[model samples]
Target: MRNQFVGKLVLVAAGIAVLLVLTPFAIVPAGHRGVLTTFGKPSPEVFDEGLHFRWPIAQSMHLVGVAIEKGEGEGDAASKDLQTVKTKVVINYHVRPDAVVAVYRDLGNQPGERIIVPAVHEAVKAVTARYTAEELISKRAIVRNDIVDALRERMARHGLVIDEFSIVSFNFSKTFDEAIEAKTTAEQLKMKAERDLQRIEVEAQQKIARAKAEAESLSLQRQQVTPELLRLRETENQAKAIEKWDGKLPATMAGGAVPFISLPAKQ
Candidate 1:
């Protein structure tokens, strides 16, 4: 009976060992990759999501989520125009599947916080330093592109791929904000003044054109009213008066049924 009990205990221990050994072969979840390392040396082979095998004694696996992950960082940077600006930037990134081993070796476990966030902050500062505060605020897309490009290039060394990057917010100093506002207001006023001047000039041109037309009409009338034209008008008036007169002759001795008035002799 004692021998049977000892044999049964040995079998139970063997079964436990086997179970422990098989635990490392479990399936990795979706969106995750298993990075296997042997004797602290990372293997070139990476296991994708699903059941994977690793050496029970000599190898250990690190599960890295290959899905896109988000990170945010903020810092103060100088603009191209020497204005200091504070900016908050957000980045979404992921480890390159083929570079998983390299990433593990270089960045170790916490790639998002250690590698990506710092790289983004550096890129943001570097790119921001090349643009003015006003440009940073208005042309944020350009700044974001620059940052993404710079970060992608920088993080590529660590086997990280930048999925997307954006500037969350940008803030300028109080003095700078006031200055920009004042400048904008001044520009608007200047444009308004220019438009007003143009309007006045157009109105003046119209008035001058109308006065010239009136002057031209008067000159034409003066040119048409000649001495011959005045004589013709007087003849027309006399003809109309004679045509309207009644034909009855006066009884008083006038000049043979026609009244004739002799003008006084001129002195």
Candidate 2:
């Protein structure tokens, strides 16, 4: 009977040891934290990275890695110009270290993908709806910032923090895409035509200025040659001829030729 008692005591001690060993759980690997709960009620005390104890059967712990994670989602949304756009977005985020308890309490286990994807979709829609389809294509960085800001606000309420959010792809409806392309082409053509017209106009003004200068010069030349000016020019020419002539008496005076003297007439 003493041997039987000893055997029973050994069995009891081994079982106790096994229970003790199994009761305490390591929350996660290094760089992680555990959310503890008592009978499904979350406790405010968060367990850091290490082995920790909980009530063997009634209490439990959920481990959440506070490291950043990436998630993606796609959806159709309307732009500010009332055009439908399809967008794919990627988000990088991590559970806020201090908000781990709140995250586990509200979202429970498996919160990473479930909480992030929907929030990203909502934020994308909200921001996309405020911009035009053209703006979404050309100014994607701004759109990304808007989406990030919105996600930050929404995720904050759920005890999540967003590290970065980006728009991976933005697609437009076939009709809209064609229309935008055609519109852009037309605008470029119009600008080119306007430039050409301006160049032609400048050339025309230069020609007009040159023609006016020529006409003025011709008018000045004509004004300098009046009838009165012509008579004075003839008188000067006769005086130059007489001054150049050598004095010699003509035989016409001895042969009864009439003597004559030329004089300028009054104009």
Candidate 3:
């Protein structure tokens, strides 16, 4: 019985020794930081990714990720034009490595839900309210910048760093979409009408130019029509008829006299 009691005591001692040896060491995964706590009180000492040492059963290590994390959220707000705007944004964020203890203490394990989501919603709403629906679509870059800036400011206070912000989409009411389509069609028709009017004006001007050119040509010809020129033209016609006369007159004449044919003088 004495030997059995000694053996049982030895086993209990071995189990406690094993527990002490195993609980002192911790392995922090990559992209994570170890947050130490004692008696439920968090410590500011941060541990990098690797094996770390702590007091057995007296201190504990909690891991908080410092790696980039993606978050997406959707929200609805009214634009400056009083139009309903549904916006979706994607955000990349991470807790600052050095601020993990404070983060763990203040924000607990779910800082994403506690801080990031609400910040995104508020930022989107605040920025969207400053722009009209058309401007939100047309000036998307500006809108995104505004939202990111707002988020950075809001999250920075809580040690959450903003890496990137993106706008996925913006949806509007069906009536507004239809109105935009109708406006586009009307503008297209107006543009086409203006183009046709310009074409018609160009054609009319070309016709006027052609008419003026023809009138100028006729005026030049009339100016050159002298009596001498007329006589010269008539003499040329008579000479051409004589060349084909065959040196014979018509068989029958309107008068009983022979045809008076003029011959060119010897030169």
Candidate 4:
């Protein structure tokens, strides 16, 4: 009976040894940082991705993702023109690996909620207020840059780093949308009318040019006609008339539309 009791004690010791050996080792996956805590208090040690070792039962490691993470936030603000502007922003960011413990202590695990969202909201509002509604739409890229710059500066204070910030959507009031539509239609019609007017003007100019060319050609022909040309025309007409005339002369020279032929005084 004593031999059996000794065997059971040895088995219990072996099980505890296995447990202790397994407890100290941890697997830190890729794109993650492990924050170590000893005696329920966070320690300064941060472990990179790989198998890690710590005090068996007295220490623990919490994994924090160091990879770029995506988040979306939205808010509404009044433009300089007093128009209500609604903005939605998408961001890609990650906590600074070296500052993981600081982040966990200060901003907690969800830094995006505590830090990023509020910063985006405030920055967007501050920038949006500087521009009128029309300007906001036109200068969207510039506003996005400003918001990103503001967010980067703001988030870095809490151990967060921004990779990219994009303004995904901007929403305005119905009045603004309707106004834009009306303005677009009017501008399109105005452009089409101007183009038509230009086409008509071009055609009129062409017609005037053709008329000028024809008038100039006729003037050149008139300038070349001299007295010599008139006399030559008269001689040509006489030749044609002689070619058709019979070999006889008209007697008495046609009195009262009828010619009285005299027989040459009977000789």
Q: Which candidate is the best by TM-score?
A: 4
> Can you write out model 2's per-residue Cα lDDT over 1-267, one digit (the tens) per residue?
999999999999999988864676645567578887777888888788877867776777778778887887789989999998889877788887788887776676555666787877788888888888889988989888888887787788877888877788999889998998999999999999999999999999999999999999999989899999999999999999999888965646757875666689989
lDDT per prediction?
0.84, 0.83, 0.92, 0.88
Which residue pairs in model 1 clash with each other? 80-131
Instruction: Tell me how many residue pairs clash in candidate 1.
Output: 1
lDDT of 2: 0.83
TM-score of every model versus the real structure: 0.74, 0.63, 0.76, 0.78
Candidate structures ordered by lDDT, highest first: 3, 4, 1, 2
Worst 10-residue lDDT window, candidate 2: 20-29
lDDT (10s digit) by residue, model 1, range 1-267 = 999999999999999998886665756788888888888888788888888777787777878878998888789888889888888877888888888777777777689877887777788889989887888877888888888888877788877888877788998889998999999999999999999999999999999999999999999999999999999999999999889889865656745553567699999
Q: Point out the higher-scoring one by lDDT: 2 or 3.
A: 3
User: Per-residue CA lDDT of candidate 4, range 105-196, in tens?
Assistant: 77778897888778888999999999999888899899988888878877888888888888888899999999999999999999999999
- What's the lDDT for candidate 3? 0.92
Ten contiguous residues with the weakest lDDT in model 4? 252-261
- In model 3, residue pairs whose N, Cα or C atoms come closer than 3 Å (at least 3 residues apart or on different chains), thus clashing, are none
Q: Report clash pairs, candidate 2.
A: 80-131
Residue 178, candidate 3: C-alpha displacement in angstroms: 1.6
User: Model 1 — TM-score against the truth?
Assistant: 0.74
Better of 1 and 3 by TM-score: 3
The list of candidate 3 runs beyond 4 A from truth reads 1-21, 225-267
* Model 1 lDDT at residue 236: 100
